[model samples]
Target: MTTIDHAVVLGGSIAGLLSAAALAPRAHRITVVDRDPLPLEGPDAQVARRGVPQGDQIHHLLMRGQERIEELLPGIGDELLALGCEKYDDVADFSQFVDGAWRMRIQSDLKVTMFRRPLFEWAIRRRVLALSNVTVVKGMAVGLLASSDGARVSGAKVRGAPGGTLAADLVVDATGRGSRSPFWIEDLGYERPVERHVRIYMGYSTWTVRLPEGALPKGLAGISASASPANPFGVAIRPCGNGLHDVAAYGMAGHYPPDDLDAMAGFFEELDSPVIADVMKKAVPASEIVPYRMPGNQRRMWEDLPRRPENLVVVGDAVTSFNPIYGQGMTMAALGAGVLGDALAEAGTLDGLAETVQARLGPLAQVAWDLAVGADSVYPQAEYENVEPPSARDRDRARAQSAAQSAEGAVRVAMRATALYMDPAYLGSPVVQETIDRWLTSGHKPAPEVTDPTDPPDVTPGVVRAADLLEPATAAGRLAG
Candidate 1:
């Protein structure tokens, strides 16, 4: 077996850290490079970083991603819980309004963890950094170091203090959507990866707030209203921790939410239901309102490249970035890391690993791409390149399936797909299609209107208040157990 003496990963976000973790067992040494001085201690440790522009937005740890991450860093679920992250049944705890009605909530085995993007990354960073073979370097990677023959990537070149060529047997680009891997590949005389874009013109505004007791209904962990062409406004409210929640409002097809607090409230008022607006009335803002815009969903078809440098692979948003509204970004990162781990185990060496991993990532990304872009394509104003939008019959079928969620069985199947627990193809199976068509033909009634509970139950069941969950000793203990 060829030994990996050193492996370098660029970008210290969830993808980068997870990549480093996946490499820890095989590589003798691993270095994670990022432009931000990743906070390791103090109050800033959990605060949003300047580098992650969407750090303040609401983020979800889907069931599939949670399982994969725990596999990579065992007991991370307990660590997050100990750090005050809230865990809830993905279906039962969530109130979803779509197709002009409330979706029936059916209890299922699927559980999801909710927290701010920064806190989740903070937790992962602490665990990855504690690995004996892993280290983090603060620097911006500018270019790839090519081998003398230019046949393979030798390492990366950073452009700041302690910056230079850091040699490695393997290099991974997890630098997110703005990754320079394409240009760097071109710089080495290789053709750039083909690109695809689905322009939805989506915009989001988020705020951190401490909700007054009883503001939200009992047993309800989140409230979401999906957007559509006719009604382009959407809103999601999810608990972060310690009574703080992230309230994010988004608009699609040029209907951007405002960043101003009052204007944002007005934006919320336009949703299908007034439940979110009512809760916002009692929310005390904990942080300034933050706004982010995603021009489109993009994918770089690296797997399609006929040839690529050895010892080089890309992961996470560098490979495919979805619309954040779907809450698939971090999960896709974790899934990509899993794919990388599987490729390494099977290859037993870095030879041909880059190509294998990239090819595998294509299908994995396509699943999410189809789901996200398929939803966006419903908007006639949405633009697309290199991909045709689904046919009208298909779109109508999809809408029927969504509207059929009032039936418990249909909702369970839909939730499983949403949680990424089942293959998206299952949704297209004859059994599922028949059920949806039957429900639609029978004129199934919409779920009853859901309102805030007059008496809210304690929503903090599995959470704990610890001094510092990131402390080395505590983190080590968590990992060990």
Candidate 2:
């Protein structure tokens, strides 16, 4: 196979880092450019920065995501686990409430680990920078540089650099959700890719709180309550490190979670279960509330464009941005990098590389896109364009199906738990589909063996006094006595 002399990668966060890793072996030199100064500190750094506005929010590295990252950067998982990140069976260790009922805690091999987004990115940045062929250049990419015939991107125009254009054999756009590749492509006299959007107007708030190690019972490291149209809100609490937990409350459409502590507590109290609310009342606040808003899920159809540059490709959130609530961003980014690596190995050179990689990326993202958009479309207030929204009847059917799937012995939970690591089509396997159908129609089945046999114990931490507290809801009344 032929090897490229040099390649350029835009953005230096998770996506850019992984892109560099994938290209390093095939290219003699690689330049990773980012507008934000790359963090040099290692994994334990807790610095929250603006480059990734959602850095402080609760982050879930799904089962598949963890495995993919480990494959790219070997021993990375053990390094993270050594830094106090908790690893456990996502099915057995987490207590989840979806479609209004708690999911049965059945033991499974699916594993997931919890860590802060900033810290995780920091770790990846360190590994990518360690590659001798990869050099991180700090600057913003103002535009793309096309070939003499204007049919391919030769490189990018770096703002405020010694030379106007940084030339390379290939240019990658990993600038994330705010990427301007489509506009740049248009200016280069090529057709812009069609785009799709699903407007959810989601607002979420997060807080980092401190609690004693093992403050709760054994075998429980995370708890979550999913949002539905009936409730329009949800909450998740997971352990980050050093006895610190990250709690996040979210609302869909116009029901935004408040930025104030007392008001935030009120939102938690309103969840179907008191587990998160009780933790909020007792846990000592370690950080102020940080709120984030996402306009919607968007996908740029680069694969559909009839005319495009042969040397340029987009990856990560730049191509497909999903609703962060589903935790698909990081995993999808890794998947894109893998596709790029495979395409390069096949082509033997940069000729016809961009189109091949971009086309392959679309299907890799479609699975996660379907899951996120399908789930979000059920809400009555969400708006979408260029896509068919789920009908009212469809929403009702979905809710009923979800409730049935949440019941004990259902295979759907296990299927979803492994979605990121396996093919999204696995959810449609006859075994899983038939299981859901039988549960819904027959209404009788043997229950799966429960990991936690006893009922949840009352572990309410006493409420503290504060004048700013939102009007008290019957807090104590919600918990078991």
Candidate 3:
């Protein structure tokens, strides 16, 4: 049986809440600490809290993430759907443009949920805090509390408290990309973990918009255009909920998207596809364009540390903060929660738990890390640390991967596997390899029917007011104000 009694989880974002869920069954009591106050009400009360600055950004549950979440909190999928989240085939209902071409969309089982990030996080947090054993404390965690011997983390030190130390049998740091785990561990007399960073200098400006009544052209639930070196700009437009769509414009290497709606339309004309631009030109803006900037992709190599606290482990963005443009953080967090549950079940004790769990979590992040970094390498000014520059061979491989995703047969399998969070190596399977090889040799030709082309759809700017799209209940919600 697990020896854990009370555990402390820092940062109550999606990651922290999920970590609490994973430990709640084994630990007699779990206290989740956050910089932002816990959401007492349901998803309706949820918004981009001060804790998650990017909470207002667009987000989705890739199929695998959807499954993992369902496993942790049964029927969450249904709850979200009933709450206005849209579920659709990832490829069939969504169009992804890469390498100046649209990915072949096909009917498949791979599906994802599109909803506001705050609502989803709220749903997960609500469920996690509902566990009788779990409690949430509002505060900012400053450091780790270590035993006198400096071998095991005994608790956490918050900025303000009855004293300052909140004791625990275990400490979980889910403080996200700005995590101070390395500094805290080093302060506790352990060596700092090595860090790897890939700088893309990414920027985002997202707006809530109202689309035409029935859906935009060919029933496409969403559209994404990946940024290339030549263009250096990207756009992602997806339906959030209540007939409102979240349109985000991003750029790589410091080419920030414009905040002005008209300028944004002009920015889209430079993209590979005019679909998003056309829609944006016609959609009614429901909210101001909110901008977010990320320095780059970063990962702390804690698993490589020779010595570490036995009763502590870091999870989620704290470990690997991937480029948010890929929408991998939430999914990776869910997977890490599952891995933590497995590690606990295997060890049955807190002894050496940090090392064992951190090691396993490293592999879980490798696939997403590689995908993000490899894809980001295409930009002109991409920077790297603790990683080598891409060679000609590396560039060729990246190009080939892009071509594979652009092809029909290969992309279907590759995309489905990726959406399901399968190993990136699966793209190297015999079937995928064969399809990619054939496409390469055949001069990169897509099928005759690349898409279900719809008639030139009518899009009229200011046709639908913001008041018409958003539910009155959300009037006092964060974005509404």
Candidate 4:
């Protein structure tokens, strides 16, 4: 095993904290640096801070991410719940409207824990700080310190208390989308990573509201309506604990949701489903309506560079930032840390660790980039280079698959892919294809409406009920048979 004397992680958010945790077992000492003076205790610790602009936004930990995080920091799920987080079934307690129809609800083991971004970060920050070898420094990382040959990073240059070139055996950048790593690397005579951008022009307006008891239909913990070209507006409402829910209205292609509360409610009213708008009628706004916008998805092709500093690796949004609408940012950050850990274990030394990890992270980031950008490509205004817009047939195929959510098997595969539990190729598997065929033959009827809040969910027509369908073994068995 290669012994790491010290590792310095830039940025103290989810990615930075998780990176520190990943380094704790191998490195003798790990220091996490961030611009914000991270709160250690009290109510302030659990709420949005100045550093994290999106801290007030809604965030959820996908089942896969939650599992990976639990592995990195055991009992974190329980701790989050103790701190007033809410865990709900991914399918059973959720409602979604897509492709001009309501999707059939099916019970599944996939769980999603909901919390504001700040609380989630705080939870991980607390756990990372608990490790005897890990400590956090209040500082802003400005550049990289390199060895005499400039072949490896020696430390980081910071701009606050104890600020200087903090020497380390390994340097990890988790500085997010605004990172200056590229310029710093270029300054060291290394090639700058190629950047890819997809212009989405997406906008979001969110509010934290206290819903009246039974505001949402019974058995439904959250509701969402996906945005499309036909109806460019969408709404997502999810529980954020303490009797509060985060309600967000989003639009794409310059059809930005209004910041005014009344106008935002009006925006929801335009969605395909009236459920969200109706519920908003009784929701008491607990916080100011917050608005955020994104230019598009951006990614740095670090692996494509012929050479990079050996002891440095960039993680999280610094590598690739997806459109926030997909909610893949935090999950991807956790997975990136896992990749970093894997690279460390495989390399058995710091030499060439950065290059190896960058190569591995490329494919991982491509998964999310493709998913987010593919969906965004549907809009004519979405701009990208060297990538063709999805053909009409492709669009039709996607729409058909979405409509196929009327079948339990189809819903299982689709939701699993959405949760990042399976490869998207599973969407084209024999089972999903067969299910889609069955759904198409059945006229693609929309899910029945439930007029009453306490009424049982309506089962869709031509449904295929298979309890073991979601299991990998069962899926493989079906493929073989």
Best by TM-score: 4
| Residue pairs in clash, model 4 | none
How far residue 212's Cα lies from its native spot in candidate 4, in Å, is: 2.0
Clashes of each: 0, 0, 0, 0
Report residue 191 deviation for candidate 4 (angstroms): 1.6
- The local distance difference test score of model 1 is 0.78
How high is the CA lDDT of each candidate model? 0.78, 0.73, 0.75, 0.78
Alpha-carbon runs more than 4 Å astray in model 1: 161-163, 397-404, 421-481
Better of 3 and 4 by TM-score: 4
Question: Candidate 2 residues 206-307, lDDT tens each?
Answer: 989886555544457777777888888888888886667898888887788888987776787777776667656767889998999989899999888898
CA deviation > 4 Å runs, candidate 3:
42-44, 392-406, 422-481
In candidate 4, which residue ranges exceed 4 Å CA deviation? 161-163, 393-404, 422-473, 476-481
RMSD in Å for all candidates: 7.8, 9.6, 9.4, 3.5
Rank list by lDDT: 1, 4, 3, 2
- Tens-place lDDT digits, model 1, residues 1-481: 3468999999999999999888887789999999898887998998888888888888877777888999999999998889888887776677777766766665555767777788899999999998999887888999999987778999999866264778888999999999999999998889999889999999999888898778876558777778988899999888887678898889999889998897776777788777778888988999998899989899999999988899999999999998898888888899889888878878867879999999888887887787677778899998888877888656655565443344554554455446752244455455555655666566656544433222222222232212212132332222111
**Candidate 3: how large is its RMSD?**
9.4
Q: Score every model by TM-score.
A: 0.89, 0.87, 0.88, 0.90
Runs of candidate 2 exceeding 4 Å displacement: 42-46, 213-218, 391-409, 412-418, 421-425, 428-430, 439-481
CA displacement after TM-score superposition, residue 200 of candidate 2 (Å): 0.9
